[model samples]
Target: MDHIFFFYFAAVIAGTSVLVVALRNPVYSALALLIMFFHVAGLYVTLHAEFLAAVQIVVYAGAILVLYLFVVMLLSIRSEERYHNQLPVAGLLGVTLCTEVLLLLIQSRTAPAVPRGSAEAAAETGNTEMIGEALYSTYLFPFEVASLILLVAMIGAIILAKKDIIETTE
Candidate 1:
């Protein structure tokens, strides 16, 4: 039952991810990416990480996808008629990476599972609480840094939009 849901989500995620790269139109590509993000949130739900699933949907599918669509619309980009001639190189690299991943998967399946320690104990503490503790305690500096970066980006975007508005009015 779980396997079925997992496979379905995985298949959609894989297909949409490919579409995200293969679609010629920027809007279509971003829409495909939005689908992929929803499927990823579904995957997180299946893993019992409900908080992560919510965050994935709200932060990625909600905010990030909206941001991407706004950028695509604002830029008014047109699709190019000719494709870049890097297909052969991309194909070769893809094949190499796929082979390496397959080998790693096979090796991991045969290896003995290591016993969990603090992580297992943390599981009893609830996902959201544990994440909160780590975010506030162990990872506070990195979390604050990420927030500061986002703040700067938001300010820069506002400034750019304001400049464009002023230019168009003048």
Candidate 2:
């Protein structure tokens, strides 16, 4: 059943997400995050959002995770034995968030479901097309801003790397 698949994906995603944060080793944490990403893509597939599923796999799991691993390897970061003192604060926030989520879930279950659009309308428009339209239309300015920010970041990274290379050669 759809519910079974949803629950399975949700459970894996939740577990892996926790593992991603709790793991001491950066590589292991990234790997856990990779598993979480795959499960998220699976969740999207279960929701009939094939394009989103593919994008999630390709963008987050493939590109972003690869970038994270590269940074981890290049930096050669060592795991610190001492833990941060923020555990109590984090625990309090976590408990508060869990309670809020539970309340929201309960409220949603009791609320009447409102149909935003008919299945025929969605089917005719297609998920990809709808997303593309919204991205290029309603969210055009924000999208462009994000792209600009990425461009600046890329250029800055290149400059910094070049300086390091020059210094090492000297």
Candidate 2's residue-wise lDDT over 88-157, tens digit each?
9999999999999999999999899886766787788889999999999999999999999999999888
The alpha-carbon deviation from the true structure for residue 32 of candidate 2, after best TM-score superposition, in angstroms, is 0.3
Total residue pair clashes for candidate 1: 0
Please, what are the lDDT tens digits per residue for candidate 1 over residues 74-129? 99999766667998998999999999999999999989999866666856899899
Clashes of each: 0, 0
Model 1 gets an lDDT of 0.91
The collision pairs in model 1 are none
Off by over 4 Å in 2: 164-170
C-alpha RMSD by candidate, in order:
3.2, 2.8
Q: What is the TM-score of each candidate against the true structure?
A: 0.83, 0.85
lDDT of each: 0.91, 0.92
